[model samples]
Target: MQKSVRLKSFELVAGDIRDVDVELLHALSISVRWPHRPKDWELFRRAGHGIVAVDGIGRVFGSAMWFPQGDNFATVGLVITTPRAQAQGGGRWLMDQILEQCGNRNLALNATHAAYPLYVSLGFTSEAIVYMRQGEVQQTLPALPTLGGELNELPSDRLTEITALDERAVGTNRARLLALLAKDASIATLSRGGEVVGYSMRREFGRGFVIGPIVAQNAWDAVHLTAVHLKNLEGRFTRVDTRERDGVFAEFLQRSGLGVAETVTTMSKGRRFLNREDKNPWVYGLAGHALN
Candidate 1:
């Protein structure tokens, strides 16, 4: 039997991401060691538009997706290129297609180390560093700050109640994306004087549940908001993506056993995506790397 054979290179073409099989997309992500399950891929497909690089035989080699939030902003994610294609500039080609499709909308993305230079060269400037924290939840959570307001679980149908608060933190109206996430998420809101002040959502993804989109007025508030979900998730695998590099909130996460697993740079192509203010609602946790 022949030990090896070199195959000739072939032409590739752009194809609609929706037209590809979910299993193929799953395989593509796995090739790059991404943690997206097929369900996650389906959720992404439903939330945005994307394109895939394919060959004559319909094999997918790469993919790039963009989720539009309102008319002026979008987040790019799920950019992947098979090992065999990366050397040939497949990643850049896929991103070019996404940029063209995005039109005039501002863009943001969480860039892995390998892709950082590519995004920078394409005009994306760094904004912040997101720590990808994950681990088995500690059996006993660290002592939380004194409860300052009512922390209540909100029915997903009442999603509208928190859209304004969400926008205040995210800097854009992502009600549509939040509605889709609500379909499978458990939401909690912190209210003071009958006014919602902070919120968090927990949903299944990748290797476990992710607690995110946590919006709050301070690190203490962020701690309580996240603790509400952690209390119920003890001993389960969980992840939280946040730009809180250091502070009470970051300390809480670290002490709770959700150590930093990796870090990604948040890059933007147009208007600034993050505008944080002291004592104002800010995103303590992100919705997702791609959705940010």
Candidate 2:
């Protein structure tokens, strides 16, 4: 059931995200200087479910969303509150509602520096630092093939293989989300001996085209996949959000024309963290911090 709390001047009622207006969510994100478009909110609505806090006037004041990786894990994101609603406990309230819906499943979220302490108070611990890179693609780069693998466009027949690799790399079965992304994005894959080993997805995003969730066998393959994806995006705006641990790939992105934009802490409050294994870590880039 939805919850409600009373403030000094207005009543804050929690309800389903479907009940909240997408324009209001977009406005709330923009009020905080987030670079999300209405389409982004639509995408979130399709891939996950969320809760919204509405004021007495039926205006949305805060929101929170969670994408279930599977039965055992989920990722929470799109947590935002209007400036006027901050410190009134709306943010915390929305978080509590999301947690309630998640039950006892492990949960993960990326937190901004300002919001870091708040999540910590709720039992989330910082795990990794993620960096954002964005800029116009000024140069046309050559396709660098991965060793033992050839770079090519992702074939529709390889969806199963891609989803399997993604589940292993991201700890989630996002086949639905991946299918939607693949339909609208230019996908590049690295194949070895008729098997797809790595892949990258690039498509129009906040500012321009964003390439990510670049799952590859190693840094070399990751960079190669990235190059292949970028070759077609030359002279266009592009962005990539990558983990700090991908030191080599991060540096490569910098040299490729994208500049560091911001960094956020990846935090989790659960029994497990995504991509915790070191063996052939294929998640070189994330789909987005929100989805990761």
| RMSD to truth, every model | 4.5, 2.1
TM-score of each: 0.96, 0.92
The alpha-carbon lDDT assigned to residue 3 of candidate 2 equals 78
Model 1 ranges off by over 4 Å: 1-8
Tens digit per residue, CA lDDT, model 2, 1-292: 5479765466888888887778998898898998888888888888889988887788887889998877788889989888876877777888888898999989888898777878999999888888888887758553443466787887655678688888778877788878767767888888889978889988778768889879987778888888876777788888888885446677678777888888888889877575556664567788887788
Off by over 4 Å in 2: 6-8, 140-148, 155-157, 276-278
Quote the lDDT for 22 in model 2.
84
Clash count list over all predictions = 0, 0
Cα deviation at 187, candidate 2, in Å, is 1.3
**TM-score, cand. 2:** 0.92
| Ten contiguous residues minimizing lDDT sum, candidate 2 | 140-149
At residue 207, give the lDDT of candidate 2. Answer: 67
lDDT of 1: 0.91
